[model samples]
Target: MEFNSLGVLMIITIIILILFIMMKKIKNNDSDTSKKLFTAFEERMGLTCDVIDLKEEIYGIGLDRSSNTIIYLNFVNGVEQCIGLSEFKGVYVHRVEQNKRSFGKSKEITEFVFIKLLPKSDLAGQISLELFNHKWYPFSMEELELINKWKRIIEENLS
Candidate 1:
């Protein structure tokens, strides 16, 4: 009878340990997913992010969780641009491979603002665009439009 009781006790202890381990795994997974989601939002907004300095990780400033999402604030050229993940729904995301024209004479390369990773429409906060010229040309309307579109999406998501 004593042997049976010990076997039952051992089984109960094992079950409890298993349950505890599963719970811990779940908590860790949720946190990892949130981190990845935030990073992707930064990419979508098309933040005027350029790798100014190389380091052990991205973002020199301390990161924080904002009212809505996480923000990795970086100060470049005397301003903070918060970088984080945004969302999209009911749309198909695709990846593609491209090759440039075989000859240098055939293809045109242009330098302009890339806005895919920026927040929509001053939505994150009221931020003014500071002019930074490249290759002797001032900021163009095309770049401004991209920035505006990102701002709009960010505003919509925040609301």
Candidate 2:
């Protein structure tokens, strides 16, 4: 078979286009599933989320600005939690790290990451929304980024 430069270029472009479309579909599906999970939580609790951030296919966080409510869901663990901003003092990211020694080499590794909502009342314990856990999920900078973003949003709403 004989191939020209233009033909090769066209074939490469088509493959790239197909890959892009497939990625888009996967992203959309993730978003759709996150929305559905959030919606079900809202209905069950009689609340609505005005803003949502889908961190992954199995988890997301949302806020109901009018009600000052924070909603979270983790499908992987079947965990769901909600808290009102008025009841919390502030929100911040909590990360745990430990040094491990392997073959005389030490490296720091993150154990878990959480977005914690500190309540105003001493009687109320901190509400932790797990963003990542080394034992359960692979480590990714994206998870850290998402937790920080939510921390800022929650803090802004608190203030």
Candidate 3:
């Protein structure tokens, strides 16, 4: 009986070790993707990123302080957009939420979130960087915080 218990403990330890290693590898892969995307973006745009946020695997945002340029990239879809701070008249956090009632409880569900950049000129189109969408990704508080952070950063640079 004691021998069987000891063997079980060993098995559990090994399983835990394997899980830890797998988690580490997954983290490393994310870092690698961010690095690659940053490098490619910098090279293609010919601008160095002074700050970058890549918490979301599907999307990334970067800023070039010297030139006051903000770049938004969609990694999975291969979509990229960049704009100068001077061109935008307003920066806003656009959030779409719906109230749902279930089980005698009310809850608000976020359907979409974005950082919208309104251009100064009416003819020029406004730009929106996607942070989260209920259809594609689950809502996250971190994304909310990130969108707010970037809004502040862009507003500061605009000033």
Candidate closest to the true structure, highest lDDT: 3
Least accurate stretch of 10 residues (summed lDDT) in model 1? Answer: 88-97
Best by TM-score: 3
lDDT of each residue in 41-124, candidate 1, tens digit only: 455654333322111122222223243332332223334455344532111111122335775645433443322333344545
TM-score of 1: 0.33
* Ranked candidates (TM-score, high to low): 3, 2, 1
- The window of 10 residues in a row where model 2 has the poorest summed lDDT is 51-60
The models' CA-based lDDT, in order, is 0.42, 0.84, 0.85
Would you list the rank order by lDDT, best first? 3, 2, 1
RMSD of 3: 1.8
- The estimated TM-scores of all candidates read 0.33, 0.75, 0.89
Candidate 2, 87-155: lDDT as tens digits = 888778888999999999998999988888888999999989988888767788787777777888888
Pitting candidate 2 against candidate 3, the one with the higher TM-score is 3
> How much is the lDDT of residue 120 in candidate 1?
48
Greater-TM-score candidate between 1 and 2? 2
After superposition, the stretches of candidate 3 with alpha carbons farther than 4 Å from their true spots are 135-138
Comparing candidate 1 with candidate 3, which one achieves the higher lDDT? 3
